[model samples]
Target: MTDKPSGKSFDKLTRRQTLAAMLAAGMVGTGMRSASAADFAAFNPGYAKNIVMPAFAQLAAASESLATAASAGCADPKAPDLITLQQAYHIAADAWADAQMFRLGPLADGQRAERFAYWPERRNIIDKQLSALLADDDTISLDAAKLGGSSVAVQGIPALERLLYRDEPLPPTGCAVIQAIAGNLVAIATEAQKAWQQAAAKPAPFAANPTEATTQFYTNLLTLLQIVADQKIGAPLGGDVAAAKPKSAEQWRSGRSLRNIRRNLAAAQNALFGKGGFAALLTPEQSALADNLKKAFADAIAAAEKAGDDLPADVSDESRRHLATELLVKVNHLRDLLRQDVPPVIGITLGFNELDGDGS
Candidate 1:
């Protein structure tokens, strides 16, 4: 459930708003007088070239494959075609999980992210909307442009997941819906990739300015970590063992909830520690912090992998649930290091108000 909305006031904040808060808090600029523009000269371009662009490109390519598979599945409605469609879906979903961490630029434009994969749907909006769309006599839902303008719940991967991952064979209408969604996904991914390519070619203000870009990327990193620990893991875990709600987990119907978490963590780790990543910005004095951040991320990813492909049966199932708990702990620790420790070393000053609360 990437970027799921919650009732909490803080959780309601948009990604842009959250980034604004980080900036207002001085969580992204150089506070050290010794720090200079030259120190971070390569940061933004490196990320754009090596990380963001490639992820979006992969997303675009995977989505094209998914669209093709959906069309073939619609024609045949056969077991093998269905299996191939599912495989393509897995590839596209993995690409999304990798790309979603960099929730800036074109990905944030025009509700594109929500339209790609709406989840953590507490009210079962996807099911209800999809059912309504399927039952409609009109052909409006089959048109990609019109469908993109419809309820986002029925416009993305979740809706397609409901259609494809079911026990019964998809009816013709359902197959049409699948094709519509796959087409929409392709359009979104392609537009995003193109937009990113253009933005990378002519850097935006945030991308051109080292301080602003650093702030943007760091804010994205912290927010993703928080989301994984809170909404992704904590929601399903619930307050106690008996209260556990495994279905609350993201993409549970496809049995990839834990896999999504692992992929998200892996992507974030790469953005932060991969070649030309933030880890390179650290000086010799910050080596210990860099090493600790790397280890924390490694431990968190390991715990997520250990949790298996899906969430545990219940929070009381210590053998598996404990791994989820361990993951939450490790992720929180990693976020804390980045939030509380890294800023000072990297020359960013955390504002008093921002430090007063978790900032969600």
Candidate 2:
């Protein structure tokens, strides 16, 4: 007689069967007619007031603290000061990771997001620009205003990371560069926060049409998932065990690439399921899909956390690489659910080629 299926295999078959049944029951494309205009009205403003605004405010606060820590570390350069500065950097970076998801309104205006943290910097541009600036150390060029107008690569987190994460103590001029970059981060964060506050009052595009505004938020959510899977993890993981390129991982110098992914997934969960979030529009009939989406996010986040802090190392070591690989798979599954299940239920139609471009 043929052997019975193993427990894991049986579970997998059961899940596939359940999904197929749900799809056949019109769970995928049947838009929820019960979702009211009032639900849409509450979604945008509530997301802004509760989720987006608070994140930016935290970012502003963290940036200010980072600037202060940078100044203290520059003056003292003591071990304690350096530790404090690094801790501040971690907090500020985490805040930015959380706030970066909104990607709408003020954050999109004036190249603000790029100015704050330029990534996928495949050319080693930050180091090149920073090396040139440090070599010259021309007082005018080092000024925050001048640097702000310079190449975006040198103006943000990547540049600051290079300055702080070196073996040798920063030269006096290097300290000055750190201070300038910290000041620039503060300015960029504050400008974004102030603009968001103003926009919250009017909430122009968000308030204009609920469906369009929600589509924007949905697009941001899916795009971030793709970036995490493709660039953040996949780039370092490469094609196979022999092909791994650990240095390509984001924030590898400070070893927070996986931490960034965890935070991004957490923020995405909040954006979708928190009070007054997109989940508010879900009808009773759509509860199963909502639960599935939530579970997908949770699974992805758990995998990221399990992968640990040293993403570069995780991707490089053949034995440890599966953790990163598993995280990538979970992220892709989450992205697929959002793309296939969410748009139909929410009444937004995304083109097949909608998310193909460079969203960043």
Candidate 3:
């Protein structure tokens, strides 16, 4: 790595500060909104469905809504007014930031694997994509300029005013999205850690993995899947149709702009389960995970088509409940398979104590 600036004065800024600078300078990001519990439906295999998917659903709505509103106003997807777009971006960024902090731990002491790795590895993808959304005006539209100075608009939430991210007229809404996305990653890690704590009394077996990296990967992957599957809100079980297909003008406009998101989802999937030509990027056990997840994704889609989204607007609670139940069960089956694999892969094959000192 280019030798980091070494002079004491130059080095004083914390990693978060350094990260902020990178964020402003247009770093990249992982595709997709944030990593969540729903992500586990693929990793764990059978905890529950619809858990982590809700947040993603909310984010998807926010993204599509932003696009729809912009389209209605005759603004190109590329021309989203910074102020309005800023809201979506920051929410995304905040979510991302939360995840980063959670996985890496506190900003108090700079930690790379724990703190900054994901930014370089994932969030940067978002920055690069969102930054391209504007033109050379380089200055906010006159109306938006006025909006930025007004205290009432933000409800006086103190502007970040930090060096990397500024208040109003954002260069890349994706960077803001990064912050939001980070939050989710952290949440996923927190839940995994929590599950681990409870495993001992129940003879969970994950604590005995062969390697820290292996164990961690499995822990992070499975626990996240369980939580999201059970929740079933955003990115709802049996609901990837919205993402896989685009409907609105914005979707058509930014049709392929989301390639990174798709790519990362593939990467994350490979890291957890291993398929879609993602095998080379994972371990042997992870490859099996990819196979298991592939089965789950296929099963969820099958269940959805059978259940049908055509339920009457006023469909009875009983019918809707059944549909939801069947959908979640499909998702749960996937989670169960993955979860069953975690203990054996980690404890018997990898060994838990091995991880304590191995991870960077």
Candidate 4:
């Protein structure tokens, strides 16, 4: 029998469920303009149903698959079957990259997003936590609930990569930890999906202010592109080709940095223009900017695909550095267009910085 995560985490949509429940009790969102219900009429609710919720749901499903694979492969971390386990982790990580941009609402609460995949390795926290957790057998358990409450460092994709991709032999307890982490991830993803679905069902939880909602949506899109440029590529690329730091890139252990970039771009496109997406609401001039944004993203994806899986090396290679540089430029241009052109037409002024909202 396949091991399963406890159902409790999925049921724990504390923040979002509370918001929706409050709405059901006829509590108006604070500052909701009572007369402006029709202002957001043109906005498509499908962005939640078709894009955000589905993305988290997919992450939950992928996390389940990873947990199952880990359970079966835990007994023999070096067994040939671990390949299947590794592939499962890749699928789950890609799902995460796609959904990472929706960092508002449920995603922003409880350190949920960071718990799934903390990046930039600011202090090599994942490795440190993994070491500590593996050595502390008394604390490790196969149960998802207990594991989910553990350190974020040892409970997500980064820790998984250390175990699955490292050349060193797995610890005696490594397999159990892997399974536990996978289960924890499953619960986190499932809860995120449920929270989004609950919020989407009630207009008050999401659309209380159409202008604010639209601005936040576009802000997320811009932020995702900026992250792609700044963190995914620029961090490893450093200031110049000579200073390239391959180890600094995301998923560098698994060599899927470019692959993650491709997934990020596709997710952004879908979120911005998918069914009931923001594209339908764009004006003629705004539509032109949107088209350019699409082209830039497509070009970026093509360049990344050409770069293949070993993105750090691709960025470091003198002849190939140009491609990485080109991708960064394109993404930056897309961000500029979104920053300068689109918001005014949509009646929202863009000022928040993607990293810190204090206008950079």
Q: Identify the leading candidate in terms of lDDT.
A: 2
Best by TM-score: 1
The backbone clash count of each candidate, in order, is 1, 0, 81, 0
Q: Candidate 3: TM-score?
A: 0.33
Off by over 4 Å in 1: 1-12, 15-33, 77-80, 201-208, 312-319, 349-360
Q: What are the lDDT scores of the predictions, listed in order?
A: 0.74, 0.74, 0.33, 0.71
Indicate whether candidate 1 or candidate 3 has the larger lDDT: 1
Better of 1 and 4 by lDDT: 1
Per-residue lDDT for 1-360 in model 3, tens only?
A: 111222332244344333432332211124422323323223322211122222233333443443333333225323434455445444433333223211211212223222212221122332232343223243233232232232221111111212123444434442333233233234333444444334322211232221322233444444334433432212222243323211211111222112222222233344433322213333564665757767776776565455443322102244354554565576577657656654443331222211122111
Candidate 2 on 102-217: residue-level lDDT in tens? Answer: 77666666556767887877457678777877777474236677777777777788778887788876655687677787898899999988877876644234324555565566
Instruction: Tell me how candidate 4 scores on lDDT.
Output: 0.71
- Candidate 2: pairs in clash: none
Q: What range of 10 consecutive residues in model 4 has the weakest lDDT sum? A: 1-10
Lowest lDDT block of 10, candidate 1: 351-360
Determine which window of 10 residues in candidate 3 has minimal summed lDDT. Answer: 152-161
On a 0 to 100 scale, what is the lDDT of residue 70 in model 1?
Answer: 82
In candidate 1, residue 214 scores what lDDT?
Answer: 58
Each model's TM-score, in the order given?
0.88, 0.85, 0.33, 0.84
lDDT agreement of model 3 with the native:
0.33
